[model samples]
Structures are given as C-alpha cells and as structure tokens.
Target: YGIAVDSGSSGSRIQIYSWPDPSEVSKEDTSQWNSVPRVFQQEDWSYKTSPGVSTFADKPHKVWDDHYEDLIEYAEKIIPKEQWNETPIFILATAGMRLVPKKKRDTLLETICEKVGKKSEFLLENCAEQVQIIDGETEGLYGWISLNYLLGQMDDYDVSSEESNDSLRPSYGFMDMGGASTQISFVPYSREEIVKHRDDISTVYLRNVGGGVQQWDVFVSTWLGFGANEARKRYLKNLINILPELNNSNDEDDFNTKAVNDPCLPRGAKLDFLHLKHSYEIIGSGDYESCLKTTYPLLLKNLPCTETPCLFNGVHAPEIDFQRDKFVGISEYWYTANDVFHMGGEYNFLQFNEKVKSFCESDWSEIQKNSEQGAYNNVPTSILIDACFKANWVINVLHEGFNLPRVGIEEKHSTSEEADLEYKPHIPFQSAGSIKGAELSWTLGRILLYASSMIASSDKISVGIAPASKENKPFVYGGIDNPSLSSQLGHGSWSFLLLFVFLGALTLAYLYMYKRDSLKRFPTIFTQITSKLKAKYNHYRYLKLSTQEQTDLESG
Candidate 1:
C-alpha cells in the first residue's frame, strides 16, 4: 500500500493505492505476480480539496495546518495501523508550485517536509525529495506510465531484451493539458531520435517480472504557455495589441478606449477585458471559421526553429509516426470533448470538427439556455461560454501545431504494408478522464514506480519476515528491517536473570512447604531421615580427606 498527493494547480488530490505485497504473495507464484505492484482500487481511495498548495506560499505553515493535515488523517484511517510505518507518502507538486517564486516554493516544500516527517507515521527517510515539486517532464512521464499501466500495456515484458524492449507492444504517448501548461510524453521508436533529442528525453526505471529491471527512454516536453487558459490569455492580449490597428488610430488613448470584437466567443456574449486598470468590453462575432484561423496563429508555429523539426514556440519534437504510436489525452482534452461535444474514445477529426463548429456557431442565448436547462450536463456558464474557444484551441494545437494527422484530411506518412489503415476515418489518439472506475492520474504511476524500485533494491523481499530469524530468535513486533542488536541483548539478559531468581524462590517455597507437611504427618520420619544422613556422612568422612581437600577437588 502507498499514498500519493498530486498537488496540481487547482487543488491537492490524495490517492491511496493498496496492492498485494509482491514480497508476501509473490514467493510461491512468481509468474502470477510481476515485480509491478498490481494495484487494487476502491471507490473511496481518493479525495480532492481546493485552492491549491501554491496558494499557501505566503503562509507556508498554513499548508500543514489547513491543507495536508486532513489529508494525512484520512490516509491514516484508510490504511491499516500496522502498515503505517512502512506505507510511504509522496507529495508531488505540479504546475501550480512551478509558478510560485523560488523562495516561496522552497519555503512551502520545506514546511510540508517538516510537517509530514514529524507528524505523520509514514516511512519517509528522504523528505526533501519525497515531498517536493516535480518538473513538468517528470509529470508527463508519470502520466505516460499511468495510462499504459492501467491499460495493461506495460505488463508484456520481453525477456530477450535486458535493458528495454522497444519491439514489444509500444507504450502509448501521453498528452495532458492543464490550466497553466501542457505536456507530451512517449517512447520514441528509434535510437537516432533518442540521440537527436537527448535533452528532451528522460529514463524511467521500472521492475519487470522476476525482479528484473526495465529502463525506458521516454520523450517528454512541456509547453509553459500552451494550456487552454493561458492560450486564451495570450489570444486576448493579441486582440488588445491589434485593437489600435483595426481602428486606424495612432493615439494610445483611442486604443485603450475602444472595444474589441472576439470571434472565439458565441454571438451576444460580452466580456470585460482588463488591461492596466483600463476595462475594455469584448463583443462576440460568433465566427467559427474565423476563430479557427485566429487560434491557429496563437500556437506560434512560425517561431524560429533552432532544430530541424519544431512543433511550436521554437520547441523541438520528434516526428510522431501515428500508425505505430498510439496516444491518450487527459484533462482539457477529455473535458473539452466530453463535456460539450460528448465525444470520446478514438479521435475522429471530421465528427469533432462538426461538433465544435456547431457549438461555436450557436448564439450566446442558446448556449446559456442549454446551460440553464442542464443541457450541457450542468456545466458552469463561465466554462460553457469558453467551450467554443477551447474546442478550437485543441483542434489547432493537435492538428495544426503538433502535426497530428487529421483523419480523412492529412497523410499518415507510414511505409507499413497496412499503411492504408492510417487514413481510416480515425486516428490513434484516445481521450479519457478515468478507466475501470479509477481516476487515471500520474499519482498512480509514481506509486507504481516507487514500489517496483523499492522491491528491486531490497535484499529481503518478504517484508514481515524478521532478519534475525536465522539466529532462532522470535520475531519481534513492529518491523524488523533493521533491529538494534544491543537493545535485544540488553532485554534478553534481564529476562534470563529474572527467570533464574523466580526459579530459586519457587524451589525454596516448595521445600519449606514439604518439610512443614512432613513434620505434621510423621514427626518420627525426620529422626529416621537424620540418622540415615548422619550414618552416610560419617562413612564419607572416614573414607575421604579433610574439608579443604574436598573443597580443592570440587574447585578442580
């Protein structure tokens, strides 16, 4: 069992995972259980709370007092009391903490580490690394591991490859679009790609069946300003920048005073844009096609390419062979498609474009009516209003910017004999919010990796077995991963001494009782016994030497 707290931008989500300990059940059936901890899930294993950990950067102490205390307490209740000392807790902060100032972020993490280490019973030997902010690349890689593990893709380990098996069923690429940033991670097929984009690659070590190690070189990259909300902010700013040109006015005051027409929003929707305390009203034009054109450039596709192949914003990315490499998208990808359009599973560009176009072209009154009447599944008006923009943004980023082939529109560029399948009405991308009733999250990946690594490195695989069992000592309570020999010996010596004194006291009491009872029953029996003793002693005294000789013989 393990716990991971995913400190994301919006809130902290605590995920508790329990698995059959590989060390315990796996000895007899190695084939049935791999080194990968087969995590079992329950409905009540996770919880989420709001305002994010980064919000407490200024008051770091409050992070424990208000944020993590309840979470830790809940974890204590969920996990068994005996397992508390061994169950590890990891607090991994994501994009939210990355945005905080360095000093504040450090302070927040320090406070978290101090609190968790001192107050919690979790096994935390390295608090600095366990409770800390993780970079975006690691976040994406963990997400990739999570998606593939949940889908059973990582279970097929090839024995022929010692380090890694690229020939096996390839791991799916992961795409996560959060509020402040977006991440893309996958295992590149060719070694040339790995060497070419070495800086963008990170190696994740996992345990294979029979306690072998598998090292994977995953390509992970993060775009800081490409998330939906951040893209919208940039698009609004771009509109403000071009406002004066539209009015053909050279004066700054005129630009500040004028209103801007935004094509991304539905018709009749009005929003206030604040720029340096100057409020400018934006009216919707409700032009779906215009929104597509405008949002496409916001990806910054024309930025100077330092490398041969650049995706967007001067970022280098290996060419994705859509025929072989499958992809799964979460967060914004799932929400934007599932919430409004009600589309999921395989990616169908034609159907998706139609849905987005229809949703975007709808009037604000119709959209609002849909929201009020629970037509959009009770989605908030604030989020529903931007559905048009988010849909267009996802389309532009995936199809135009990332160069993901739009089914029925773009060539797949595959050389396989069955290459014709690449153009078959749908791409290899999948959008999912959860799988098998469990929330698909990177926290699961972290716990899986951690469990595998710990098992691989441990000398004693069986956890509950005492190390001192070889010495014929009884297994002590608590864990015996490391026991103090001095303490054990000290306790043993006192126990033996107490037992000796107890036996002596018992013998004296028994003798006294027997003599009293014998005297009461037959007083003459003592006289006869004494006479026999004196006769035997006299015979010994005549046959033996003095008492000093006897003492010397006894000493010798």
Candidate 2:
C-alpha cells in the first residue's frame, strides 16, 4: 500500500494506493493507483485591533484543528475496515507543516495520529502503526513522481526498467510552492554520477538514445508571499476603489450643485434627472456597489472616447450621461476574477507591469534593513514577479541544461537548427547555475528515480537529500551508515592530531632555545683553561724569541 499526502498552503490531500501484482505493475502505476481526499482548507477572518494592529477576528487555530479532524473522519469513512490491518502504508506530508513551528506541527501531527488510530480500532481488531510524517524532500519527490511519471507527461526521458515486466521506471523532479515556503527536489536514475556519465556516453556512442528523450537536471521553488485567497482579496479591493457608482451616496448634500447643473437642461423644468439620481442611489446602496464604485473612475480615466455617447438607446440625455458613467462602473466589475488572484491574459500582464513599476519606484530601504528580522513584507507586484521569474527559470533550465526539448519547439520551428536559432532567450532561463521551482522539482524527481533503481530489490532504501543551495545543508535519512556522524569523528581526529603536533613542535623549539642561551651565558671550564695556556705559551715564546734575536745579532 502507498499513501501520498500533498499539503499546500491552502489545503492537504491524502491518497491511498493498493498494488495487486507488483510484477505486472510499472513504477508509474504505483503513483497512480491512489485515491485523494482533501483534508484541510485555510480559514478567512477580519478584525479591528489597536490603532494599527490587525488580527484575525475568527480563531484560525480552532478552525484548522476542526478541519484536520474532519479530514481524518472522512478518511475513516472511505477506507475499508479490512484494509486497515497490517498494510504497509507510506504517508508523505509537505508544505503545510513547514509553515507552523516544529512544536506546533508535532502537536498537530500527534493529534491527527491519535484521532486516526482511534478510528482504525473499529475497522480492525488490532490497529496498524501510527502515521509517519514524510520528510519534505521525499514528499516533493513523490509529488513529482505522481505528476510527471504516473501521468506520463515526462515519458520522453529514459528511466530505469523492470527486467521481468519490460516496463520503464519513472523519474521526476518536484517543485512545490506552498503558502509560506517552497521546496525543490531532484530524483535521478542513480546517485553515482560516474556511472550515469558512462551509461549516457555508451548510449550516445551506440546511437541507442532516441530523439525527444531528455534528462532533467534541476528542480527549484520560490515562495511568493501572496496565497490564492490573499491575491483574490487584493484584486477585489483594487477593483472596488476604481468603481464610481458604488461610491455614490443617496444624500443630496454629498453632490456639488454646480457640477450637476447644465445650461442645456431647462431651469425649473421638472425632468427625469431625479430618476437617474434615484437609480444611481439604488445601485450605490446595493451589495455590488462596493465593486462598482471602486472600478468606475479608473475605467473612465482610461477609456478612449472623444465625447461621452448615449449609454442607452432611448433614455433622456442626462440619463444617458449618467448611465454611461454607470457602464464604466460595470466594466470594472468584469475584472474581478483577473484582478484579485491570478495573473493571466494580456490585461493582467499590463496590470502586473504597472504594479512592478510602482514597486520599483517605492522606497524599500527599511524593509531591506529589517529583512533578517523577517520584517520585509511583499505586495502583489513582488509576489507575481517572483513567481513568474521562478517559473520561467525552471522552464529555461529544463530546456537548456537537461536537453529537454521545449513542448512546442518542433511545431514552432521546421528544423532543430531553426528552433535553436529562433529561440529568444529570457534572462531568467539563460542562467544555468541557478535553478528555481519547477527546475528544482525536475532535478529532484530524477534523483529519486535513480535512488529507487539502485535499491529496487533491496529491503530498505537509503536516499541523500541534497541541500537547497550552497547556502544551506542537506538532510539525509534511512541510512544503514550515517556518514555525517562519521564525518564529525574524522574531523575530531584530525583536530587532535594537529593539536599534538603543534604542541610537540612548540616544546622542541623552546628546549633548543634554552640550550643555546645556556651555552652563550656560561663558557666550559676546559675552554677557559685552554685559552689561558695558549696566552702563557705566547708570552714564553715572545721572551725566547727576544733572547734568540739578541744572540743571533751578536753572532752576526
């Protein structure tokens, strides 16, 4: 049995898979034979706090707890009672747990486990083991495997194969961006780079490699601050601000008399102008008025019209003008979906560009300074740009580094040379060293497939999780041998050897210096005696030479 759990910022899903005959099934089949039941959804709330402070009006903690309980209840209801006992189950958890503190996450997990354990008792005489929280990287790999491998979306790439079934093993890289964080993982056909290199070279030399098959090298993720719901709210609020009719008040005191007065309208001639005013007032009072009033003014400012035309086919001239203004308000409402949460189509791109411009022009020095303290906050512009950049980067790396052909490359270009020549390079995708979101996921998926292939027949599998980047550390698990712990021991031994060597050298140098100083300070007695004897002999020789010189002079 296999269970894959995908928890995004907004929601969570639990899937259970049962494999009937392992020999007949492909690796991709394992990922697909699962059922998903959504577990949790984020709650929305509002509040008025102290002067500038904002807090959720509704209790989010309680809402989440209840949601989790409901998910457990749903799972219990769906799964068969007989299937609850002694089934080898795998549970993978991702983004949601990462958002909360470790302690809180543990508590939440324990709570869910307890609830599930209790429910399992009714189904089975003896309940199976409690649910295990899969590591983030593992969960990401599972997602990648399910999406690309099981879905057969990335079938072009060569993966491992089962000898018995002649079925291709699936490889994938996963890039997941949740509400609070992003994770990227690469699952390859093998962890041994040299082996993979040799295999690739041999395949290439033999011309065994097929066209359209491409290896994936990297997977990456970037966390943009705005969630879907938050994006929606921002878009809605912006829409409301541009609508004019929604802002119109029924009170006559609110309008300027001079502005409304027109020389064309007969003075003291009771006309249907009041009716237009009443209609406007009615729209302003309605629930949709908020959206209309906020969007209308901006629409009018941008509309390309030499003169305001008759808004309706047969209405009073004043009423036509009023209705035209109202139509502007209605036009703004049409943008509600695009403005709030998603960036799509031509208009969204234009709006996104404007937002980017505004953000670039705004002062962010304070935020930069406080970034380490987690005080740097993002608005819609930054978030959308970040997501787009990350997404583009992933796409670019997949095409370039991995030799993965772009989906539309052939259709767009008649030949390979033409495709390569005509491809307009994007800045984000051009960089080979940097991997973001989807690219990171792709890399991770490939790595997982590689690891799985290595231990395909083994009872246990060991996987090394690569660090996110050079700046962070990688997590490793399911190891029969812990290399990190051994590495620490090796470091300590080297440090001890260096310490003794340094001290011994220092002591030998000190002893040599002491002996040299002693030799300089005190001369040996034998040397002093020799020096005196030599001086005496020199004196005797001089005397004898003087006497000999006198005798020789006399003889001469």
Candidate that would win on lDDT = 1
- Ten residues in sequence with the least summed lDDT for candidate 1: 547-556
Task: Write one digit per residue (lDDT tens) for candidate 1, span 1-556.
Answer: 8889999877898999987766665676766443456877688989888878989999997888799998999898899899999898888888877778776776677678767876888976444446667666667877887887887766646445544644534567899998778889887867777777776566666665356545566777777767788789899888887754545655545444457899999998999888755687888888999999998888888898777678887777777878777787888998887778777555678888998888888899998988888677688888888899999999998888778887743433333211111112235686777765567888888777766655544343331112111123222111112223243234555676578569756765776787556446444755675566544433333222112111111000
lDDT of 2 by residue, 1-556 (tens): 2233333444554444343332233343444222111111112111111210011113334423444444444444555667655333222333444444544454454444444444433321111112333444444444444334333444333333322333323333333433333333333333343133332111100000121112333332223222232232333344333345446675544433212211111122111223224311111111222322332332123434222321111110111111111110001111221222222211222343343233233333422343434432322433432322232222222322222333221112122211111112221111111111111122223223322322323222233333233214233221112123233234555576578569756765775787656445344744775566544433333333223321111000
Assess candidate 2 and give its lDDT: 0.30
Q: Using TM-score, give the best candidate's number.
A: 1
- TM-score to true structure, per model: 0.75, 0.34
Clashes (backbone N, CA, C under 3 Å), per candidate, total 0, 45
lDDT of each: 0.71, 0.30
**Weakest ten-residue segment in model 2 by summed lDDT:** 200-209
For candidate 1, list the clashing residue pairs, or say none: none
What is the alpha-carbon lDDT for the whole of candidate 1?
0.71
